[model samples]
Target chain A: MKRIALLGMPNTGKSTFFNRLTGASARIGNWPGITVDLLSARILLGADMVEVVDLPGFYDLHGFSEDEQVVRQFLQNNPIDLLCLIINATQIDQQLPLALQLRRLGLPTVAILNMADEAEQMGIRFDAAVLTAGLDSPVCFVSAKYGHGFSEARETLRQVLERNPPTNAAIQHTEFAADEALLAEAEKLVARSVSMPRVLEHGLTERIDRIVLHPILGIPLFFLALFFLFQAVYTLGGPLQDGMTWLLTTVHDQVLAHLQPILPGWLYGLLVEGVYDGLGTVASFVPIIVLFFLGMALIEDSGYLSRIAFLMDALMAKLGLDGRGFVMLMMGFGCNVPALLGTRVMRSRSLRLLTMLIIPFSLCSARLQVFVFLTTALFSSTQAPVVLFALYVVSFLTAFGTALLFKNRLPSREPLLIELPPYRLPTFKQVILRGWHEVHHFLSRASRFIIMGVVAIWLLTHLPPGVAVGGPQSLAGIFGSWLEPLLRPIGIDQQMAVVLLFGFVAKEIVLGAMAVIYGLEGDALSHLMAQRMDWVQAFSFMLFILIYTPCLSTVATLRSESKSLVFTGVSIVWSLGLAWVISFAFYQSARLLGY
Target chain B: MSMVRLSELAIGQQGIIGDMDAEGQFRQRLQSLGFRIGKEVRLIRQALFGGPLQVRVGSVNVMLRRCDAASIQIWAER
Candidate 1:
């Protein structure tokens, strides 16, 4: 199959173009050794089966950034057919040097100048003849967002592929001996080819940034945005989740009634309450998690996320963490597995490792389900969101505290050189696609642990001709009693203690396992949860969930990404220990205050 | 034109970039981003005390730290 590798600098909409062309949300499989994630898809383009690989964006090929290294490694390791480079049309002058560098590689190459719509709005005009002639390559103007210029580009790519064919030669990689000359040449070419109006026409993005990036207003505006985001998540998502749970459990009950007559009690319980109820419990929360992802997608694609990085760099710097790491940390709230996977873009190993340590402390949506259920059952409507939001604040505190503790050991050398791109309201389609993409990843990667853990917890309670379901003679009861002593200081009893152990597989299972272990479902489970723990104990349990070791999927990702057993081991041990001490302190202190 | 550090330039100020003290990968990054000798750059904005400064180099806006910005000498029109 013919292969085309997509390459570009950051913020060029390269991945957007790749997705539009391929129409697939390609998964990032484990590609070891500094290459954490790379996306590729196979698609047929005009009588040709082509594999399109999206390389991480980087400034210069010779640049020492980890992204640059990954690009070089991929190009050198695998033989590729065509090098397709994407450039932001508005920033062609500075970006063309990269185009020039790619042209020097002697590989079959085609260039796409994306965001042509924005370029046109700014009164930036490009002389196609001059651009193509000067660059000495085939280049096309495109706006990936509107799906314009794609058909012609597709045809152009096919023709280029036919002309060059696949040489089947190894593309030897080497640094540019003199990037200075190539850069000079690119500037000279851009000068003759691209023309722009003086004063740059109008500025919507600038006007918005004036308020959004304003020092005092910026931080508050940021918090307000998050506040509204979470509000929307609950107000809208709560009903959808409640409705979904009702529908699923209604179906589960009917199936259970029929199966209870046909199958033995053990088989019936294993299938219904063990598998269906547990999976359905977590599955119902999917809407809320997807909604959270959509909210974040809007913030990210609007270009405000970068503004956040700019606004927050100083504050986080004081805490010994960079602002960009905070972006990954926010992503952790959706799922810590992706958060660890997302750290691949960073150039510094130390910074990446530190970020991995801090991300697990994020109250991911999996844990969010447990917290929301417990809080709603315990607190009134007005107080539930507040309690939930406080957990978020505490999660952040734990992240910063971890950073402060590890900053000396894992010193980051990368400078805070982030691009504050012009704000563009992200399209509705793009936001949904992002939401779907993340949800799909979560389902694919996390479903195994969710199903397996639920079954294990179910079997533990059901096996050996139980004296009474979920009673002291049962395996779950026996195991929980064994763990009770360790957890006693933290105020978690035997029944809840074992749920925490099962939760290690995946945090989503904590709530599901609770339902199964307690022999309760839906409101009854929540009712029991509320009655079982007082405010102080409930608060301690929430802290324990927030600070404990990362879910197994996250641990696997950390193991693979960090590629250091010692580091991953330390991450687990440290979080578990920190969780114990913090929970113990809060429980003891709160008890003394007579709450 | 008297030289001033990029971090020293006020908001809405314009300058011609001059000798930069950056080295290695950082130099290459800045140079590729259109921050070089004789390039016309502008201070788009600055965040609160000792934070990142938003600067326009050619057509691209970059968020650069104050410490790094201070290392670049620019000839400013007062």
Candidate 2:
């Protein structure tokens, strides 16, 4: 099938336009490289089903940035039928040069002046006919956010495809002299075709940036934003999570009651106790995950996230990371899978690798759930938040400290540089769509691993005919007892060891696994946990869960992102070593203090 | 008539880029970002602790490290 690549500078509404045309929820963020990977969908235009690929946004085709390289490589490998070059209309002077360069490639190309609404609002006017005449291509004005002038864009695409222009040889010869000449010509063309507002308006974006990016207030406001973000995730998503858990439990119980007599006891137990409960435990976190993504989308779409990179640059630089890497680490709090993918935003491989090494230390929501459950159960309501906050701080410190130790060992590359797009109010639809997409991605990617893990645990606990469930006679029981001595130093028992094993699948399952191991359900499980473990042991357990090896999905992502067995192995070993040492220290010291 | 490094410009100060002293990919990257010679730019802000400098080149705002900024010669507007 013929392909049309949607190419643009970073944060130019290219992904938004791609989503509008293809009806695919390609992630649209106000920051750069949100669409790190090329997202292609079969889009129907005037009865022709052409593949539309959304390439990662870049400033110039000749640039050496990773995203730019991805775009360049893709163009070389895949023959595109039409090049849909999207430009921010307000920044046409800066954007036009790339468009002019792309035009020389001699592909049947169309230039889209995206965000025309914003341009108009800012009193920046562009005469499309003038630009079209100068470029020898159709230039259409479009607001992808509001679905304005899309028919013109679509009609242009259809016409371009019908013309079927041949790819020119100019694309093959990319000399710096030619690029400079093209840029010079582009500068003249932009000056002639576009008119700027006489009085440059100091608009809302600047007003907000005054406070948000203030020398003193920026950092504190950033933390406040984070505090509220976590607060929203826990507060708003709490009841929904409970509702989902309650609903899933009901379904499992009903299914078990119905199937108990029909299926063999082991088979029935595996289906309900193993698969349903295991998957259900992970599933229960969907609400919070959705909320977290929603919050991130809002921040990202409003363009505050880039400012975060701006504010944290100095601190991040100290750890041999860019502010963008810090943004990715913060993203890890929601889920490490996407955060691992987020590392693609970093231009250098070494930087990406180092950032990946540190991300697993962030307290992901799954781990957060376990901490929330334990802390709430074991401590007073007032102390619960403090304990959870302390865990988050520890997670940050661990990630930063890890980065510091490895920064020098890793090969150094480019320094931190980023674009801060003007802040705008995120649309309600976009936020909801992003949230839905995240939840969908999570379920599809993580469910199989979770279910398989739970089933494996079920087998270990249920195997050997006539063996007691989860008792010393079963496989898990034997394994846990054998491993118990190693864990005993950290105040962990056989039950906790087995639950930790199951937790390797996903952190949220530790709670459900705990309920199963202790042969209790719901509130009784919490009560039992409180009665059995002292605050010190509970705190140690939380610390271990906070720093231990990432869940199976995260490890899989690490393997894929790093594309090295050694790196993945190192990640696991490092995390395990840290968790052991830290938890041991905490437990031992607490005892020494005679608390 | 003095040409000052871009890093020397105060926040909100405007200038016309005179010469870029960087080479190869770094130079190309900056040029691609609308920092070509004669392009008008304004220093938007500087991050704390000698972090990146946020500069407005034409309509686009970009953050550049102080080291990179120091290499770009500009004629500051009075």
**Which candidate has the top score in DockQ?**
2
Off by over 4 Å in 1: A1-202
Tens digits of per-residue lDDT for model 2 on A462-516? 7777788888999988989998999999999887899888788788668667755
Looking at model 1, give its docking quality level: acceptable
Error of 2 at B51 (Å): 2.0
| Candidate 2 lDDT score relative to the true structure | 0.79
TM-score of chain B of each: 0.93, 0.93
Q: What lDDT does candidate 2 reach at residue A328?
A: 87
Please list the residue runs of candidate 2 whose C-alpha ends up more than 4 Å from where it truly belongs after superposition.
A1-202, A248-264, A411-413
Q: Each model's DockQ?
A: 0.32, 0.33
Report how closely model 1 matches the true complex, as a DockQ value: 0.32
Best by lDDT: 1
Taking all chains together, the TM-score of candidate 1 against the true structure is 0.71
